[model samples]
Target: MAMHMAMEVDQADDPRLQAYTSIREKDLTSGHGARFIIEGKVTLETALRRGRFKLESLFLAASRLEPLADLLAEVPADVPVYVAPQDVMDTVVGFPMHRGVLACGIKGEIPFPANFLDADAKTGGPSTLLMLSGLSNHDNVGACFRNAAAFGADAVLMDGQCCDPLYRKAIRVSSGASLWLPYAHGGTGADMVHAAQAAGYEVWAMTPRAKAQTLGTLRVPEKLAILLGAEGPGLPDDLIAAATPVRIPMSSGFDSVNVATAGAITLAHVFGARESP
Candidate 1:
């Protein structure tokens, strides 16, 4: 591969490098439609290779650039790749410089839930989707996406209340699966269930309620949407009432599991069941 040169940043405040400055604060204040940061070598590589989001710029610790030459070569020439000394990068990002890799990319428009579901139908195969409601923890959101990808879920649908899966921490935790997987954020939990039903999916609400069907015994459908909610609240009563509630059976004492864990178990079961005769 031909060598590509990245612009060097001697000063942290260069106007062209503003997106990498004080990243945490910028991420919080910046609206969802704006550019978001990607951190770590793996995450950066996935974003560049996936080509889902448009790359805006890359900021790397000057010392790490040589080791990342091949990956940097994959970047488009027109996109700015900025290399800064370790101390300067620390100053710009307002954090201790460690992993030494970061990139910024514009947020692409998310497809509507109905459109995403319809597109899966057009594929003419079994479909699985994960729907999240009021899941505020970035870690859980990211882990859920990772699990979705692992268990063959076609897409993830998040209600407006769920944390952004693109949040830097979430993206990192997901090992960049958030970028690779298709997702949409909008509407109420009830709306998501209804949309899945309209798309011919058997919407299964995951909860620990006594009335819920045990996951081990329930028959999985060809097209299934598994609904999960925040850790403590689980699914709303109305949302639970709207769909068939399913639970992971446990020993007598344990009543619940983390939402992401529950999602993984449920997804694995459903995906496996769909494969059986």
Candidate 2:
């Protein structure tokens, strides 16, 4: 591991740190230009390990240097890690995130969802994909990524209406799984279903509707695409009609779980079914 000396910063508005300025606002309203923020030591380290992103720079509290030095060695020599005192770091970002670490990562060109599905098809073996629709809540989005990773899903596909999984809180809530999971936003729920179908994946639309088959009956095909919708509205009826509709068996009158929890349960069942002799 190579150690690079860190640059010290005394001012909050240092032009070099411009990308991190008022970042909470950017976290809420906009995507940083061709870049996404990765915060926390673990998530930053995971991004480095995943090797899927180009790390632009790092901004860290001075105290983090010794702790993160070994991991920093793996970062390319060209990337600067800016070190600042705690208060200066707070002033620069206009908020205090106790995590004390942040990295700017360049977003690579997002390939179509079918591109990933195609890659899975080339294997001629079992493949699993998690699909999301209209999930605007960052926490739910993050939890979904976490569940997808836990169940061994190959990649995650989301409709445009879903929140960006790279949003800082989402990354944090995912505990860095978002950094490791392969994911992309496709067009819409129907578009995702078509993309999956075109790629030879059996599309299973998750719903609470009684007409849908209980998930207990599924054996999980060699290539499976499971679709989940936003909490309140669930999957659109037309989209559900298009795909094989499946529902988790719940209490008689009660309808649903949190979307993420629903994903976890379904994915767990699929994982177990796939493992069974």
**CA lDDT scores, all candidates in order:** 0.86, 0.86
> What residue runs in model 1 are displaced by over 4 Å at the alpha carbon?
1-4, 28-33, 118-120
Q: What is candidate 2's lDDT per residue for 1-277, written digit by digit as tens?
A: 3434788999998999988998988753244457889988789878888747788999999888888878888877789989899999999898885778999988766656766666546557788899999999999999999999999998899988998888888988888888878887857778888989998889999999888999988768999989999999999888898899999999978999999999999999989988888
RMSD of each: 1.7, 1.9
Model 1 TM-score relative to the real fold: 0.95
Clashes of 2: 0
| Local error of candidate 2 at residue 89 (angstroms) | 0.4
lDDT of 1 by residue, 1-277 (tens): 2335678889988998888889877763136657888999999999989848888888989898889998888998778888889999999999986999998988867766766666656445788889999999999999999999999898899998888888899999888999889898877888888889998888999999888888888777777899998989889999999999988898898989999999999988887787778
Q: TM-score of each candidate?
A: 0.95, 0.94
**Model 2 TM:** 0.94
